[model samples]
Target: MISDGVSVEALTQWQEATVGSLLSQALNRWPDRAAIRWPTPTGLKTLTWKQVWDSAASGAAQLRADDPTPIAIFAPNSEGWYLSLWAVALSGRPLVPINPALTEREVRAILMDSGASIVLAARDYRGRNLLEAVARLNIVDIQHLWDVDDWISATQSATGAIGAVAPQSTFVIQYTSGTTGTPKGVMLAHRACVNAASTLIATLEPGDDETCCSPSALHHVGALIAHALALARIGATYVMMNEFSAQGFVEAAASSRATILAGVPTMYSRVLDDPSFADVKLPDVRVLMLGGASIPVTLVSRLESHFGARVAVMYGQSEAPVITATRLDDPAWMKAHTVGRALPHREIQILGVATRSPADVGQIGEICVRTPVRMVGYLNLPDATSKAIDDEGWLHTGDLGALDVEGRLYFHGRLREMIVRGGENIYAREVEEVIESHPRVAEVAVVGLPDSDWGEIVAAAVVPRTGATVSADELSAWVERHLARYKRPTSWRFVDELPMTASGKPKKFAIVEWFGAIDGN
Candidate 1:
């Protein structure tokens, strides 16, 4: 059984470790164990621990020979992407991952911001020629850009020794989703990533033979720390998906006999919506992990019943990889409602917005976290870093939540997203939960629209289930039965789908624009 208390010994051992050291340890302990499984059009490709180490060493040598500065990877999830990540990690240079879904302009902005001269990119992903597109940008800062396949081939044939790196050195410059504003480069040190992955490994206690099916993008922290690094620490196998499709995920899970499945709420909903999901039997799956967004209670219950697996919920951000997670044995309500208590070696506090002091139990306030897993700072933005992490070492998360007497956290909503209708505050999450509970609703995103009379009014963008229809009057009456009049949505838009980020969170800014376009305001 997992203990709630922190493990001092584990922290002491991992506090000064680098990703290279972790790779070495895995190589020594589990030389013959399967480290990765990549499904291709031809067949399944499996790599042993020793093979992964050799490939990483070769790639690292090539990187050290070509450039000494931080490198960037622009590709979808694939064997080439994994090899590139290991190459950068072993080379003692930071890696900047750019989402494949981003536009050329967005990609150029990140490259310029990160100053990554060497970029290993895919030749083509989905339908776009990523290499040609990046070449078209012709950013002068980008000195060397190699197609991912060519780079892998060149690196695999080369050989060199791994460089020595400090534990506190930055390993990755992860960019935020930029849903609220321009994306910031979050500097994550080797120690922080190692410690965070170790903490989660201890909590999950995955077996050596376990296989995890992950469909989340490798660029996001959820896939990097939680699934990839965590699985590598234990020498387990992880199945990679280049793109997420309900049919693809179900097929992969069945073929791999996966023990753990990880994804965001939207991915889970899609899998359940797939017709083949009802016919498949995944008896080997033991845990279904959810992260990246708020999970609806109904979704949790449905996942548990469908997969016959325990649902484990986690909450985190790019600034802090993972703050809290629910255990496998947690009660159903606790798993569905709360984000669980703070993880080991982490402290969570609800700070009063006005005074910036600790709020009383069950009182809503801005969520603050003090943990070793936090990012060093925003790259090249000292003022922004200071504003995010205070002098007291507390990282003000800007998310509003409350803690119960037992220390379990209940997330309310984003502090900035709160709606103040004539001085009364309304949390978007509260209203969303009610609408999602309705039988006809598939998903909903609530926002605060500008109103001249009430200052700001509640607005909702709802996606109804396929072939199911419900009018505004029906939803208004449904919400009225559960929420106060002030909290109910005054404006509604029945969209086929909500705009979403790559990591699966709804894009609130885009929804607000939709409403604005309709109102001509």
Candidate 2:
């Protein structure tokens, strides 16, 4: 296995550290440095490493004095939101971070399923009042509820109660949307968080003065681990946004002099499409880490050209956080084509779909990983957990990919997302990448529609650029030139925009339903 700039000894040393301990170390090292920075409607705000640690200690002490049930935080990205997560971990309780964009029913399901007894949320955001929604649920498990303002204001002296937390204990239960349209709670241990943060800090080599600007929500794994925990581990600065806007991110990066920017592909797309994108200049930014979704080959080139920064594409899921990440010093071709090799202490193997055996080099198969940075299991779902994690402890990711001889992973598409047309297997991402290469295509999603003749035919739904008109025939002709005839999209639907999930992934099920309704199938 490749070392990837980190060593096994270093990973082992961090194996027994809890999230609370990690933050404490950072606070001790840089008590006066700014730990968190964000722009509010009132003005810009800042928090020192000592302030965050003390707030977390106070919150932890308060929760321990109360019922101490699983704590649920429903709020946007803010300094308070970030501290609450650390507070729960330090209190020896599992934290459940619900997406603020979830519907009332969805929020209720998570609170009830996770048995969360304490809730901390914003009074209202984006026209949704979480307090109102919680009042309607009437969940008995929730014994205490406080708004963000009240929670932050009630900070008391640090009681040093965080020392009670164990290293291997459960830290958070992150609920992610499943294929069946229900959210499954993935339990992550403190060691898992430590492992993930260690890998990210070692591979990325975050400098002491480096400031990172993150646009992802506090609930996302990328934000919780890569942006928050990793930043604390290295004593770097964090600049977060309450709401994501292309222009807002650009302005924040420029003003904060951010050296690193982390985001999903959709966020980058919006930034590139902004009207004032050409005028923005952020000279301090040296790295742009894009993940949590597909990164188009063309977008990588455009990002580097515009920002004068090296782009590093990372690949991982909620189950295993940041298993692989490309380096900043890697070649441009490697950064654009592959997601890089496995982390120093992690093991990745591509297993064949039908045979259930390891695939040879350059062969596409299901991407499986064995790593310390993994979820404990799905909460209260034994069968589902068993099916996802095998007997030997390998987490079988549903995504399909292949490994090069040098251990670099080349992602194909989701195993369920592959289309079988006339007994020929066709990957949707291969088609999507080709379609996204077209200059007029702003965004595209490829799905399989029910077809009696071919069993399932390749279909694509595309959103053209603003003020651009694109026909189905022209896109079909373009696809035929890059891919095989069978792999080309049999049907194309042009729309104003593509539906996305709360975590910024293309909603394939919604796209399929739309196609069925239009075709009368």
**What are the clash counts of all predictions, listed in order?**
0, 0
Lowest summed lDDT window (length 10), candidate 2: 1-10
lDDT for each of the candidates? 0.84, 0.83
Candidate 2 clashing pairs? none
Candidate 1 similarity to native, TM-score: 0.96
lDDT of 2 by residue, 346-429 (tens): 899999988999999999999999977898999999999999999999999888999999999988878989889899989888
lDDT per residue as tens, model 1, 110-219? 99889998988888888888888899998887888898767767766786677798899999999998655678999999989988887776666565477899889998
Which residue pairs of candidate 1 clash?
A: none
List CA RMSD, all candidates.
2.5, 2.9
TM per prediction? 0.96, 0.95
> How many clashes (backbone atoms < 3 Å, residues ≥3 apart in a chain or on different chains) does model 2 have?
0
Worst ten-residue run, lDDT, model 1?
Answer: 1-10
